[model samples]
Each structure stands twice: as C-alpha cells, then as structure tokens.
Target chain A: MPETNKKVLILSVNDEDKDIVFRPADTLLGVLRGKLGLTGAKPGCLNGDCGACTVLVDGIPMKSCIMLAIEAEGHKVTTIEGLINTKTQASFIKHFAFQCGYCTPGFIMVCHSLAEKQPHADKAVIKEWMQSNICRCTSYQEIEEAVASILAEE
Target chain B: MIPVDFDYYKPESIEEAARLHEQLDRQKMLPLYYSGGTEIITLLRLDLIQTKAVIDIKAIHECREHILGEDYLVLGSSLTLTQIEERNAFPLLTSVSKEIADHTARNKITLGGNICGEIFYREAVLPLLLTDSLFVIGGPQGVKILPAHEAFQQTMQLGRGEFLIQTLTRKDFLGMPYMSVKIRQQWETGYPLVTIAALKAKGEIRAAFSGLCSFPFRSKRMEDELNRKDGTLDVRMDRALRHIPAPVLNDIEGSAEYRLFVLKNTLTDILTVWEVEQNA
Candidate 1:
C-alpha cells in the first residue's frame, strides 16, 4: 500500500479551526465541503471554471477545487462563509443582489476578495474583475451597482 | 469531483525531482508534474490525461526565483503571473498577463505551467514571442536553452516531460508602446478570435498576430511592407491586409469569416494607433 500524508489548515465560518492530515488525492474543495461540512463554497464546476468554489488563499483569490490540499498546508484560507460581516451583509440585503441565491455565496466571496484588496475600485474595474465569475440569473446589474455603492462608501 | 487516485510527491530540490523522473522513466506509473493545477486539473477531469504519480513542484525553491539582469530577465518556472504583475518589471508582458483573466486565475497560474501546457493563445507566449524569449529546459538530455518559438512547437509534438525551468527575455526592449488585443465573448473563456501585439522602436515597427493561425506567428510580409522607403502607410497597409490568411479560425465562439474580418480590422486599428504615436 502506498501512503502520502500532508498537513492542511482548514479555516471555516464554524468556530473551530481544524488542522487535518490529508492524502495527496484530496482537493482543497473536497476537504472544505466533505470533511469540514462547510458547503458555502459550492462545487459548481470542479475544474476552476464556474468560480463557485472560490476562496482566499493567503489573501489572494483562488479556485479551491483545482488546488491540492497539500499545497495549502501553511497558507491562510478564507471561504465565503467566513466573509459574513455586518457591513457586507447589510450591503448585500440593501441592494437585493441575489435572485435565486445559489450564486450569491460565490459572488459575495469574490466581492469580499475585491473589497479587501481594492476597496476604491471604480465601477468599470469591478465589472472587469468580476467577469471571471458567471451569474446565470442575469442579476449582475444590481450586484455591480451594490458593489459600486459599497466601494463608494469606503 | 475529486481527481483519480495518484501517488503525490513534493520535491524541494531540482536534483531530487530530476532523479525521481529518471527513476520513474516511462514505467507503468504515469507521472505528470504540476506547478499550479489550473489547466492540469481540467485535463484530469476530462480524462484527457491519466497519471499514476503526480509530482508537485511548488516546493522547489530553485524553480521559483526571478532574476533580472542587465541584458535579460529570467523568470523561474514557479513564478506566478500575479508576482510578475506586482513587480511590473516587464510592462508589456504585465499588460498581456493582466488581460489573460481576472486576478484570481493569475495568482495561481505559473509562467512555466502555461508554457509547458502548450495551449493556443497562451498570453505569456505572445509577449515572449514579441520579445524573442528563450526557455531553459531541464530534461534527461540535460539543461538546454531553446528559443521560445522552437520550444512551443516541440512541446506541441512531444508530451511535457521535460521541465521548463525558466524563461529569458531581452531586457533592453523596454519603454516601447506595446498593445495586445484579444477578442472574445467573455473576458475569461476559450481562445481569442485574433490577438495583435505590436512594439514600436524608434522609426522601426515590429508587430505580430496570433489566434488566427495554428500557432502564434510573425507577419513577415506585413513587417516588410512597413519597412518601405516611401514612409507612407497607405500602400503598405493594403499589402499587409492582402497578406492576412483567409478563412480565419472557425472555433466554438466565432465564424471563420468573422474572425478574418476582425483580424484585419484589429491590425488596422493597432497600426493607426502606432502611426499616431510616432507622429506625436
């Protein structure tokens, strides 16, 4: 039997910070949703296309599904569930940015990443950066407006 | 969905990685080396590639250095586009890399990964071609310096076992107004219809077009036309437009005629911008 062991740091919205040993076969998304039970980072396209499984690895936005768990051993990981702040939550509700709400978490995660990095980004730059994430509900206008408003406040 | 089960090894040193590859040498254990899993993960999901052992080269420190010399800029294999953009050492290359996708994808995707993957319209390759870059490849035959165009052509023929250690580009070709245009439905999907990259040095102009051909190609006919003694672009522009290949790439997003039309229009627009800048 072949064995490979690697340490991984799993950060979730849940109160516990779990440090687990993983096999190289396990992906970062697998560890987050399967082992840790934090499914906010939805698994829409596991091949890094849908942007559903987006997360922040060491303060940088990344598609967790394509990343190996072992590669994120010592890095700080932040997920959508972890981004629920009072200000952000208030802005999300005021704008009514979500329709079906299935894509809300991904959008929020991306927004959080952007806001943290470039809080003063203009409307056009935000739209350009958010182009990587697709919203099937066609509710991008409101979402973009809401994000712009939030950035304006900052 | 998780990828197929495979033994994983993280090698901290290049010698260890080379030794492991030598040991596994075409055995039943199919080995695929990965720096960042952006493209490889998709290949795994589609079963386009199957591997028994996966070598993670992220931990190799030697493959992660970016050395800027007086004459050339050498970027290690593990250096991500985000890192390059942050440095802003190569302005033209940085512009092309930023336009590849959003910052998220740029953070994980590495220079060597895209080069070794050999996908059409790989953003890094375009700037590298424009700058006449060279690739330092580490293979069973030992380390060798390969011209960027030749390396890309050879990689398309042979599978990516030979590791591309670093990319080298001439540093003196800086401060030139460089532009790259990519036509796509969305910012981050399939290949572009046509991409035009141009560089202006003094009175001489160098430009190349890709995404319409089987591979990224230089428009020698177009360059020759620009070199005429008349200094008037009217006839040269006509000749250049005539030399553009017909029946442009008919892919999932666009028609062949549409691509060709866009290609010609884009070339004209870029040349016009260059002419205006030169006059100014």
Candidate 2:
C-alpha cells in the first residue's frame, strides 16, 4: 500500500480540541468548514482578496482561505461561531450592518478583533482595519456604524 | 486550497532547513521554502506553481528575529508586514508597507515573501533599495551576507536551495528624510498604479519604483538626472522619466501611458515635499 500523506491535526478551534485528518494542501478555511463543520467562515473568492473567510488567529484577524490548516496548529483559531454574544455582534444587530448577511461573519470577526486590540479606535484606524473585508451589498456605511458604535462604547 | 498534497516539514534551524531542501531535492520531491506562504498559497490555487514538498522556515529563530542593533536594524524575512508596521522600527518601511495590501492581508505577508515573491509589484523592496540594505541568506551553501542590490536584480537571485533569512539596514538610514507614495487605479484597496519610494541621504535623493514597470528597480541614470542641480524639477523629472529602466507596465491595473503620467506626478510630489522639509 502507498503511504498516505494525510496526518491528524489536533486543532484548538473556538476553545475546543479537534483532531481531524488533513492533507498539507488543505486550507484552514477548508478544514474548519469542511472537516470540523465550522461553516461560519465562508469561502468567498477563495483567494485572499475577499475577507469572507476572515477569522481570528490568536486575536489577530487572518484570511483563512490563504492560511494552511497546518499553520493553525499551535494557535487559537476563533471563527465567528466561537464568538458567542459579543458587543460587535450586538452592534451589528443594532446598526443593521448587513443586507444579504454573507459578509457579516467575516466583518464581525475583523471588527471584534479591532475592538479588542484598539478599544479607542478612531475613524482613520477604523478605516484601516475594516478595509480588508469587502461587502458586495454596499453595506459599508452600516458596518462602519456598527464598528464605530462598539468602539465608542469602549 | 492547493489541489495537490505535499509533505510539510518545519525546520528549527538554518542548517536543518537547508538539509531538508537538499534531501527533498534528491528524492525528486521538488521542495520549496515557505514563509508567510501568502504568495505560494495564492499562486498554488491558480495552478501557477507545483511542489512535492515544502519546508516551512518560520520555526527557524534567525528567520523570525526583529532586533535593533547599535549599528543596524535586523528584520527577519518571516516577520509579517503587520508586525513591521506595529513595531515601526523604520518609519519609511512602515509607510511603504502600510500601502501594500489592505490591513488584514498584511497580517500574513512577510518581508522575504514580498521581496522574493513572483509578484511583480514588490513594493516592500523599494525602501530597502533606497537604504542599500543587506540580505542574510541561508541554504545548502550555508549562510552568507550579501548586499541587497548585488543579489536582487528584478527578483532575489538566490542559488539553489537558498532562502532569505533577514534584512539588515543601517540605523542611520532608518531615520533619513524619506517619502513613499502608492497611486492606485480607482481606490486604495487594489494593486498600485505606481508606487515610488525616495530618501535623501548626504544631500542626494535616492529613489526606487514599482508598478511603473514589470519589475521594481532603482536606476543610477534616473537618480542622476533627478538630482542634477542644473534643471528645474519638471525638467529633471522628464529626464528621469526618459531613463526609466524598462517599458512602463500596462495591465488591468493601468495603461503604460497612464502609469507614466501618474509616476511623474508622484515623483514631483516627493520632490516638492522634500524640498520644503530640507529648506526648513
């Protein structure tokens, strides 16, 4: 029998341990959504251009599609599912930050990290952080408001 | 996701990384060094490159070092663009890197990855070229230090199995008066129409360019023309434009003619800003 290249990856996703078999070529987005059933990170563009698959790796926002599953071995992978009831989520609801709801998870993850990292984020800083994600629905105004409202509370 | 499976090895030291590359080559594994892996992953998705194995060099200590020595600032190749921005060890580098990609993508793009990448618009190398930085490379030939300009032509000219470990810039160069600008086609989110970085050292203006041509470059003739005290800024800029190293790039981002037009304005802006600063 030919030796299989697949290996067991013990991942810490959403503060839980998951041991899943994966190939080295599999992306973090693929493993999270396909293997672990953590489908919150949508695979839009699959390239790094779109932030639909944005997730927090050790509190820093990363595009999951570009990041390999093996790279997430020693780090804490936080998908939108990991985010329970958070201020960014609440602010998104309050501000109506979505039209089609496809980009909300990715935007929420980025905004959530921004709120934690820069609690006093201003307009410039907010724009710098939020520019990574794209919303085809043109809901950037409401998304900006949602992020601004959360940062204001902080 | 990459369509094909490849063996992944994480090497702890430069020697180990080099050895893995050699061994993988002997086994016909077609190994490639991985750091940041943003470009590799992106290109892999498009079927642009193929590899049977990958050596992840991020675990090597020297490749992750970001230190400020008394005489130099040593930045590891694997250090992410975001890390560089947050550290801001070299203000010019920070400014140039800030405009490379959107904020989140910068979190994964690294110094070595940007410089050694197949992507033509290697905007990060502009500041390094202006500073005359040194590259620390490791491979089957062992580690050696080489001047960035000598080893980097259009791309990093590395021997087989070699990879860039770190970049060392003179501490004095870090604080020099500098300007960096990136002009995009439409908005700030996409790739650049033209990106220019300039630094004034010892009463001379040194410049490098990207997106204006197929590859990033620093031309001696262009700098000489720009620095000539005999001509006005407009004349000097026109002369410099004539000496551009290659045909201006014309792609989806911009046309060759439009790129030259934008490059002229950006160069004028740099000169104008620096002129005021120098006089003050």
Candidate 3:
C-alpha cells in the first residue's frame, strides 16, 4: 500500500481516545477492525447500501465503511460498543429486541445517535430513520417497538 | 470493494482546490474532486472513473458555512442535509431531505454532491427549481453564478468535472409551495414514479415535473392556462393532464404511462392545495 502520514484522532464516548497515523488507502472500517480491535461495527456491505456498519461521526450517523480514516480526523466518532447505557442496556434485555443479535450493534448505534440528536422523534420518523439498516431475520417489528417504547418513556 | 490506488490531496481552501485543478493536465490527468464520497464511491468501486488523483475539498472552511443573509441564503457545498434540517434554515428543503432514506445516508451525502452527481429522484433539485436557486461554481476560468435550472442543464450537457462551491437563493422569494409525491414499495431505496414541484404566487403558477421527460421540465403551457382570466383551473387541469406525455420514463419500477398518470395526479393535488392557500 502507498504510504502517507495521515494522522486521525478518534474520540470515543468511553474516553478511550487515540491518535493514529494511517495510509491514504485505509478506510475507517479497516483501521477500526484491524488496528483498534473494535469489532462491534460489523463489516457488512462495504458499499453504503447496508447500514450495518453505521457509526456516529461528529454526532451524525454515517456508514463507517465508505468513509476514509483521514476523513474522520478532527471529528468525534462514537461506535456501537460505546452506546451501552445502564438504562438502555437494561431496557434492551427487558424488551427482548434482539433475535440472532448480529445486527443489534448497528441498530443500537443508530438509535443511540437518533436519541441524542432527536429524542422527541415520533414512531413514523424513527421508522423512516431505521429504513437504511436492513435486517434479514425479520426482527424489525420488535426493534421498532422497543425504540418507540424507550422514546415514549423518556 | 477497495478502490484502485490513487494519489489523494485535501486542499486547504477552495481557491487552492481550484488552482490545483488548473495545474493538472485536463486530458492526461483525470482528477476527480469530491466533497462527500456517497455517490463517487460507487463509481470508484466500479472502476468507471479512472482518475490519477482524488481531491477532497472538505478541508476548505468556506465550503462548510451556512449563510442566512438579509437578501440571500447561501448553503456551503459541504453542508450536509442533517445540518440543514437541524437548523431549519430551509423548511421545504429540510422536509424533502428528511424524506430521503435515513440519517446515515444524509450524513454522507452533501448538497453539492447531490446536485453535481445528479442522483435521480432528487428532493433538493425539485425544491431548488421551485425557489429558483442559483449555484456558485468555481472553475479554472473563474467563479460563475448560474441559475439552478441552467446549472443542471449545463452539467447534464457537459457531464461532471466542475466544482460546485455553494447554492444561493433570494430571501424575498417566499410564499412558494413545493411538494413531492413518490410511490415506493419500500421507503428505503424506493424510486419515485414521478416528482412534481409547483411555485405558485399571486395567482400565477410556475410548475415543473420530473419523470415526465429526460429531466425536470417547466410546464409553461400549463402555467399560462392557470394565469388566464376565464381559465378555471379545473377545466385547464383536464387539458393539462392530457398534454403530459404518456410513459415518459419506462423502467423496471414503473412504466411511462404510470409515471405520466402519477405526475398528473401530483400536479392536481398540489395545485388544489396552492389555490386553497392563496385564497385563504
């Protein structure tokens, strides 16, 4: 791979921040999985079609697969693993929102971002926002209900 | 899919980016300038765009400012739809942007990328058409401000390679009603059969319809009929409905006739609402 000293500072919500220099060819996903050992962000559909690799870039949900590591420099990034709250995690278990749990991390990340940005969003808007992430196991109904319940309580 | 090996450069400013483009050999060096990589990544993955260098323009500070001035509203090229929605600077545009897929897609997609890439079923283009927005393009020659419609026309004619710096619209252009109707099997990745935008003011209607032609087209004949003294729009609508060519777009998703019918229905619906608002 061609080499260039492109340093990126990743400020995770957990205070586990790090600054690492990457090559121009490295994607955000590549650096996260290969170097950082943060495997919560699943590598599914490197293209932007599937939102399985969604993450919060500067408080906005984005597909980490398509973004270059260098593009994320000077921006705050929050991944799925960093989204666990004592309350929400308890509610996720109480509501039973996961089936096989493969796509749970992405959903948690997206919902966390949405809740932070728009906690008052209605069910229709939440459904509209969740359309980007596809789940093959048909667990969206439960996921939708859980998200709505959480928002309703808050 | 990983993109082919290429040199990457992030310019510090828009002027520097423009100068970088000017220095490159236009023919020999295929430099692709990108603000956001939502659409460009597809081309890069397919190896359709064989460029020696990819210039990232997000580093330019001027490209990210959203200026709500007294006379005009200027949206920097790199401004994301999410930013626009949060600010509520442009309500109609924000409504349309929210309707598009989800937050993730909106974050990666930029206003300049949407206009420059010319993605079909575009919500921004329709609202822009209704408001008569102008695009500020910075090229090797100099900066040129072209009407939004003319910008799309010129870009569609010449293909892509120009840098869109910002989009500007007059603040006085108010009371314009813009609406979009799309029938999709699924909300995400669902293509619209037809999209119509109507700009009605002072009993005058300037309407445009997409999915009825090669690109979005103004219905001057329909507009004229709406403006006529004895022209009750109910009867004019019947005539206008017929003039809309059938099956303007035929794809796997929908037929041309179906698109025409949707376009007519959409126009009728929006015009009725517009008339009610005008009368109220």
Candidate 4:
C-alpha cells in the first residue's frame, strides 16, 4: 500500500470522490472492476474496438478499457451502478435490453451520455451512438427501442 | 491480456515533457507519449506497443490550445474527438470527427492521437491534408514548426525527444464546402477501407484519402482530373490510382481487391458531389 501510494489517484466516480491506488498502465475498466469493486462497466474486447466497458467521464461516454486508471485522476467517472433508479436503466429493464446482461451497463452509459448531449436524441443520433456497444445476442433492436423511449421521455 | 508494468509521468510544460522524453531515450527505456490513452492501451494490450515507460502529456498546457485565431484555428493535440465533433466552429471537421469511430471511443480519442496516432485509420488527417496546416513540433532545441504534410510523412524523421505540440490551419479553410466520406463494408464502426475527403477551396477542388495506400495522402492532379468532366472519369481514376500505385490494405476488414473498388468508388462519389455542388 505504501509503494502504490506513489500511484494514488483521487477520482470522482458516481458523485463520490475517493482515493484509489492503481498501477501505471492499469486500465480504468480493470480498476473499476478489480479494486473499487464497481462491476458495472464490462470488459468485453478490452480494446477501443468494443464499447462494452463504457463509462461517463466528465459527462461524455468513453471506453474504460482503453483509458488508463492513472489518466482518470481528477475526472468525473460514472458507471452503471450510478444509474440506479434512473429512467434510462428503467427503460433498459422494461425493454429487456439485455440477454446475458454483460453489455447492459455499457449501453446504459452510452444512452445516458446521449441524453445529456441531445436531450431528445433523434433516431439518427441514437443509431450513430449505439454502434460502439456491440450486443452479441442481437438484442440491438430492443436496446435501440429502449434508448429511443428514454429520449422520448426527455 | 495485461500489458507489462510501466511508469507514468505527467509533465506540466512542453519543455519538461521534452526533457523527460530525452532522458528516457538516453536510458534506453523506450518511452511513449500518451494523451487520451485510447491508442496507448489498445496497442499495449495487442503487444504492438512495447515501451517501458508511458508519459501522459495531457498535463502539458502548450499541447491543449484550441483557439480560433483571426486567420487560423490552433487545434490542441489533446482535444478529444468528441470535443472536435461538438465544436460547431468547424462543421466539416465536426462531421468528420463524428464519423471517425463511435461516440464512446470519440470521447476517449483525441485529435492529436488521431493525427499522430500510429494506426491505419488516421481519417481525421485527410481534412488537414487538404488545408495548409502546419505542425508545431517541440524538442530540446526548441519548438520548430513544420508543414503538416512534411511532418506527417516524415514522422520517423523527427529528432529524438521531438513531439507534435499543436496544428495551425487557416480558419477560412473550415468554411469551404467539403465532403468527408468513408466506404466501410461493415456499418458505422468499421475502419473505413478508404476514407476520402474533398473540399472546394480557393476555387479549386482538393482531395485526400486514408487506408487506400500505405499511408494517408492526397492527389491534387486527381482533383483536377475529376473536375475536368472529360469523358475519361473511370479511366482517369484508374490511371491516377496506378500513378500513386495505391496499395489496398489486405486485412480482416477488407481484401486488396475490395479496397481498390472502394477507393475507386470513393473518388467517383466525390466527383458526383463536386458536380452537384458546381451546379448548385
């Protein structure tokens, strides 16, 4: 703990700013799931290609897998755990936007960010933003319907 | 697949970053500059990047300058792709940046990373290629600004400890009508086999492409030929392709034959856009 103190980071996650220790090259996805015990962001591809580990940094959707935990210092990061009781998560639940539930957190994060950017996101923008979060079970239509519903509510 | 352990440092100034880079190079640690961390993590996981130390340059203020000067726009290297997309300051650039990847990755990927990123899909560079953009490279000797084309082509030519600071492009170029396009067999998220960008500037059509050749480039002569409307559009495209000897990227996303067809289609599509714009 003393040695890792050299890599100590104070990050704002889910409206709570906490001090966390992470390695130099450790990804935010790893730190969220491994150390802090926030398993909301999934580690699907572990590359920027797959958006399964999506989170909101400073209120914008980002792939946590490609972002270093050390780089996340002093930034606001929001995961699916932060989405508890939110309308977007409720929409996902209602529309059955998950099969295995691995990609649900990431999809919810993306939709949440989309709503912030475009409070009433049209179909084109929703279609464009959902491309990164891949749903292997082919539940994309339901997910899109969920996101569109969230937008409609806004 | 975890990347090997590395040390991270965030320098506050360009001089400090350059000094750190030079020091690391002397120690044979193979230091890599990092900003946004999107490319750094992906390449590291793939074992493509084997550096011992990673320097996060986002802390450097000099590299984060995004300003619209009277004549040019100084786009900071650390500006995220999402920031560039939302910046209605450059509408064509906005659309192009949005098409780069998905919204999530865009939030993590930076403009400088996309430009100096060591990847095949440096699609954002196409617009800068069409304009007279120059790169301000910082090193121990000092900050030396080089034309964007020469800097991009001669990245290996950069001296030790040298890195790109920011880009300066004429602000008026952003106002010129341009079309940024990509032909990806896979929908939205696929790396475009051939990303084409063409703009009408100074009363002449200029064009650039990525993924069609070994590197991102443009063809002024091809733009001229496309504008001529001589009965040889198809023949001219074929000849121009052969002139540069465009090499198709034969990868999982596309085959060489498919890439060639995409390049041809992209160039022809630009001509059609040009025709429509000319009439309008």
Candidate 5:
C-alpha cells in the first residue's frame, strides 16, 4: 500500500469548488451521492450499460459510475442539480418526457450536454447522441420530442 | 463502488510512469495502468480484478497525443472514442468507434482502454489492424514502436510494466475506401454479433473482424483468398470462410452458426460495395 491512496479532491460541481476526502477506488457517483448529498445522479446499473449516472464532466457527458472521483479533481462536473431554468428542462416539461423519473436526471444531463454541444443536431445526430441514456418507463417518443423541440431553437 | 483501496499516481511523463510501474511491481503491489477507468471501474465493482497500485497515464503527454502528421496520424491512447469520432481523422476508426458503446460511455472509454480492454469485442482495433498501424509502447526498456499487426495477436502482447502510449497510422490508409459494419444481435447498441472492417488498399482488399472468433483478428489467408482474381465473389468468399483463424465464438449475444451467417452476408456486402466503387 502506497501513501497516495487517500486524496482530498477539490471538485468543481455545478461551478462551485468543494473539497472532500476520497479513496482512489471511490467512484464519482458514490462520492457525489454519499458525501456531497447531491443525489440527482441516480445509480441504476453500476455498470456502464445503463446511463443512469451520467453527468457532464468538462462539458462532456460522462457516466459518473464509471469514473473515479480522483479523476474529476481538475474538471468541472455539472450534475442534474446544476441545471435550472434551461430550454431542455422547459422542453421536457412541455413534452411530458419523463415517467417514474428514475432515469430523468441522467437523460436530462445528456440532453443538456447535447443541446449545448450540438445545438443544430439533426434527426440522425440526435438519435445517436441520446442513445446513451435508457428510459424504460416511458416511450422514447416523448423524450425524443423534448430533445428535438430544444434543438429546434437553434 | 470498488471495495478495495489502491494507490493512484498520475505521471506527467512516460518514463516516470514506466518507472513507477516497475517500482510498484517490484514491491508486489500488482500495479495496473489506468486510462478511461470505465472497464476498470466496472470490473473492480464486481471484484473481478484487484490491484494495489493504479498508475494513471492519462496525464502523460505522449498518451494525450492527437495529431495528423505529415504522412501519418498519431492518436494517443487516452483520447476518448467520442473525441476520435468527432475529429474524424480516420473514417474507418470513427465508424467502428461510433458503435462501441453509447455516446456517454464513449466520452469516457479511451482508445487504449478499449484496445486493451477485458471485453472481447475490441472493435476499435479493427481499423488499426487493417492499416497496419504503429503501436508506441512504453516500458522499463523505454519506448518501442511495433506495427499493430505484430503487436496485436488475438490481443495486445504487452509485457509487464508496458503500456500503450499512442498509435500511428499512415495517412495513405486514412483516406482509403473503407467500410465498417457491426451487426448487433438485437438493436444498434449491444455488443456486435459480428463486426467487419474492410479497407481497399493498392487495388486489393484488406479486412479485419471482431466478435466472429474468440478474439479480433486480421487473417492474411482469408484476405488472400478473398483477393484471388480467378474466382467469382461467391467462390472466393466460400474459400475465404475456410480460412477462419479460429473456431467461431458461441456466446449469449449470438451462436457461432448465426455469427458466421451474419459475417458471410456482411463480407459479401462489403465486397459488392467495393466492387461497384472500383468499377465506377
């Protein structure tokens, strides 16, 4: 055991830099939900198969479950809690995109990143990007409609 | 979350990383190189792999190299699949990477991580194999460059304390007529039933495959048979099928027979499309 196992991570979550102690093996999702009490990013499948733990790291959508907390030390992590009064949220509300809501945070995070990164995303591009998250509670139609409605703004 | 605690080091240079790995191995620490950490996190949570030290190589400059050289394209191992796809320096690679996982996972799954991953469906290596790219490996003996064909046999033959830094592919093969197709068992996202990558170079077709056998491979014999000028497309394909490198895989995604069936159709389609391009 080397002396570098425990680390004090200064993570920039939703634009605020917070300090916390974490082990090298601790995942970002665990630290966020347990230590920070930011439970927006749901933990559905610990595996990367389900994108239920997706968050934006440096403006890129990344599954927090698959990412080590220590790795996010210098990057900006934008969780679902970070988003407020955005077009994506408004569109999701108007389109009735979510049901049961277990996967909404992850879906919203991915959708927000997509809208910010590729605002003019076409049908094919939208399908490709949004395929990252899985929402089994409701039909994919409403979710796609929500994303499409926001992308239409650009 | 992973059940065990391990020391993590982010080395800024390749030599420092190699030295750290050697030191950790010498101390019986069971050191492992960490990149994207996607597969590592998943496997660690299941207690499938254990390590006392993790050397994070993502900070190394060499592992972050992504450049289009004068005659080659140098891509670092730590570059995420989405980054590669967005750059589109290599169309065949972009196509293969686009189908590896979903977009979010790709944002985390790095090139080297996928190539040297635990999962068998290493579709990202297909294009590198087709182009005979150069694999830059860093180890205790310093850096060594080997052709991808030589470095990869069923899987990357990396020695202890050795890690991939980046891959170099000749620019000539970058723009070659190539086709990358991954046929999933059910939908567009799951593991491939059989993924085929074909590149037409020097008026001859070169090909590689994944999910067909136990490991991804580029069979010279199969390519030779497929490139034979005397036989019709069917005849050549039948002969090429005889040269499959190993017994086809029979896994939950698909049975071996079904995989071969899909593989044959895919190979035929690729050949037909390339033939039309050649005629045009």
Candidate 6:
C-alpha cells in the first residue's frame, strides 16, 4: 500500500518503528541528529557532495543530508550507533584508519555497507567505494587500509 | 542547509500520479515528480531549483522493476545507477555509472535523473544515444514510447504533468562493440571534462559526446565522415572531428582547445582500434 502523508514512520535502529514528523524540507540528517538524538551521523556539506551524513537506508548506504526524512517511510534506517559492536568498528582502530576522528563514523557506515555487500573487497574496491566520503584530514590511505583489512579478514 | 517547505505526495499508480500532477498543475502548485530524490534534495537545499510539491514516484512498483526481454532490455527509469551497475545490465552503463558519485550517492541517483539532470557530463546517456533505445513516458495522455534520440530531445522538455517511466533497448545492442572514455581533471568522483561514447555495429560507427557543448549531443557529420572510410583512418578521424560545430564546450574544468585536443586524439585512437578490429 502506498502512503500519502508528510509524516513518515521508519523502522530505525533495533527495528523500532518511530514516527518522524518533518517539514518537507527536513533532511534525514536533521531528523537523525536533532529529533531522534541519533547524533552518530554528523552533518556537513548539507548537499550530496560530502559523505559526513551517510547512513544505511533499507541496507543501502545513502546520503542522509540529501534524503528527506519524510521520504524514508517504511524503510529501515541505520546510523553509526548501530555499528558500535561490529567488527568494522574494531577494525577501524586495528588498521589505524582514523585521524582527528571526525570522519570515522561516516567511514564506518560505508565500510559496514561494503562489507555486507562484498565481504572481501580489495584495496582497489575500497578506494573506489569510499570516493563519496571527503575527509579534510587527508587520512584516506589509512582509511582504505583499515577498510581493506577488515574485508580481507573475511 | 535546510530546504524550503513543500508538500510531498506518493501516488500508488502511474495514472493516479499523472492525475495528481494534472490537478496540481491546474492549481499552479509547481509540482515536481522525483524518484531517488538525491539530486532533487540537493538542488532544493542549494536553492538551485524550487517547487511547491514533490511527488514520490518510487511508490509505484513499475518504476523499480528491470526486465530483460528476449530481444530487448527494459530498464525502469527509476533504477539507481548502482543497481544497474551491480546487475551489469549493460556494460556501457555499468562502466559509466560505477564511477559516478560515491557508493551511497549512487544508491539515490536514478537513471532518469542522471539523463535528465541539469548538470552536464551525463555520460550514462552518451552510450544510450548511440544504441537503439527508447523512452517510455507516462503523462496526462497515458503512456507513450519514443525513440531514444527523439526522447532525449524531449526530455526535460516534458510538459507539466509528465514523467519518464522506463527505457527500452534492443538486445542486438548487446552485440555491438561499445567504448566510453571520460577525461576527468580531478579525482575519481570529479566531473569529466570530456566524455565520448561510440558504438560499432554492422560496419557502421555511431558516436556521442558531452562536456563539449551546451548539452550532450551526437555528431552525424563526424560519423558519416568516418563511415565513408575514403582515406587513412588517422586523417579521416581528425577531419571528421573538425566538422563538429563550435563553440565546443569550454567550462572551468577545461578550455575548448583542451577539450578538442583530448577528443580528437582519444577518438582517433578509438576509431583506429575499431578500424583494426574491423579489417581483421
């Protein structure tokens, strides 16, 4: 059944459906960081150019800042908080993937998505997939190493 | 940056969606039909475009389905670039899209949005123009199908209450040897300075280029010159390109001279390769 409403109910972390009332302009990033208190997904660029607001929507990594909160109806939304205990998180430290740590959450979510799709993504694949994320810290090589190490472990 | 306030509608069927659009247009509501919403949201936030309402077309199951027919490949317009790339539906599409944006953005950038988008370098559509493709459009007049080249002309030229539904490709296109070369001044995600796509089938060549004009286009004069095969491959290739109308595209990323240089040398190489393969 199709829906016709401004408010959308999304199955958020832990498969809990939450009612999110948003202005037509409210982005998923705003809702996640403001209303839901799921601040794991940082806000930056506001446009799709930056990946700081990336999240998993229905298992697909999408730019939350460019996604309308009202558009996520009936879809599953996962933030960096959902990845706390995951191996990708542990591997981040193991591979020394973070510098200054501002972009770690975004990279974690992307790595989680990549690991789910291709558990053994090589360094080339990791570099290819991570182009969406922009880290001013210039820690990309280490980030790629971290992500590839996790994928290689599988 | 927050977006301007607007209404959102998700209709169940194509007819219902079209009707809603008609009703909205009649009221001068300035409705916009969107599927992936990636470009829509960004443009809205950046104040690049505005609308009073956004109709969610993803609710229609038809827009999400991709069907591989016996003689044709039917790709729902709303299919994301990442989805098509992952499925390897078409080699040209996969190669072009795999490098577009990033992992997450790809999930939200649909085929129709890329083809009909405002910014150029829409390399995905470059290959489609060379092949026998068609656009299935849904509007107030119900469903209508138009050839790919004609549809490309009418795309974004669509009237107030219309949307692209799907794309139809002849299966024989799969047998055509295709090439897509993009010269980007920046990193992987950087916009291409020049995009060239060509298809060789039945001893004929069809080529389309972008980032070289106000919009992407194909050059029949160039194609005819190359197909004539009157002289040496290298000279004919250069002469054919010289026939392209100017001013060829010159943007911040590249100057017109540089675009022509890259296009001439790269296209010549591609044509040379094709000539060798054909003669062999």
Against the true structure, whose DockQ is highest?
Answer: 5
Q: Candidate 2's residue-wise lDDT over B92-155, tens digit each?
A: 9999999987899999999999999998888999999889999999999899999889879989
lDDT-based ranking: 2, 5, 6, 4, 1, 3
User: B210-238, model 1: which lDDT tens digit per residue?
Assistant: 67765666665777786665755666776
Residue-level lDDT for B222 in candidate 4: 68
Q: B-chain TM-score, every candidate? A: 0.87, 0.98, 0.86, 0.92, 0.98, 0.94
B171-222, model 5: which lDDT tens digit per residue? 9999998888989988789888999999999999999999999899999999
Evaluate candidate 6 by giving its C-alpha RMSD to the native, one decimal.
Answer: 1.9
Q: Which residue pairs does candidate 6 place in steric collision? A: B212-B249
Q: Which sections of candidate 5 miss by over 4 Å?
A: A1-5
Better of 1 and 6 by TM-score: 6
Candidate scoring better on lDDT of 1 and 3: 1
Q: What clash pairs does model 1 have?
A: none
Model 2 CA lDDT for position A41:
96
- C-alpha-based local distance difference test score of model 3: 0.70
Model 6 DockQ, alpha carbons vs. true complex:
0.63
Q: Model 3, B96: alpha-carbon shift in Å?
A: 2.3
Enumerate the candidates' DockQ scores in order: 0.48, 0.56, 0.44, 0.54, 0.67, 0.63
How much is the lDDT of residue A50 in candidate 1? Answer: 67
lDDT by residue (tens digit), candidate 4, B84-161: 777767776786788887877887788888877787667777777788788888888989888877887612236778
Instruction: Write model 6 residue lDDT over B138-185, tens digit each, in one string.
Output: 999999988878878513457658898888888888667888887887
Candidate 1's iRMSD: 3.5
Lowest summed lDDT across 10 adjacent residues in model 2 chain B is found at B1-10
Q: Name the TM-score of chain A in model 6.
A: 0.89
For candidate 2, write residues A21-125 as lDDT tens digits. Answer: 999888999999999999999999988888999999999999999999999998999999988898888899999999999999999999999989999978888
Q: Supply every candidate's count of residue pairs whose N, Cα or C atoms clash at under 3 angstroms.
A: 0, 0, 2, 0, 0, 1
Superposed model 4: Cα runs more than 4 Å off: A1-5, B154-157, B227-231
lDDT tens per residue, model 6, A14-97: 377776666767888888888789988888787787788888988778888888887676678888888778899999888788
TM-score, prediction 3:
0.88
Docking class of 5: medium
Could you tell me which residue pairs clash in candidate 4?
none
Q: Please give the TM-score that candidate 2 achieves against the real structure.
A: 0.98
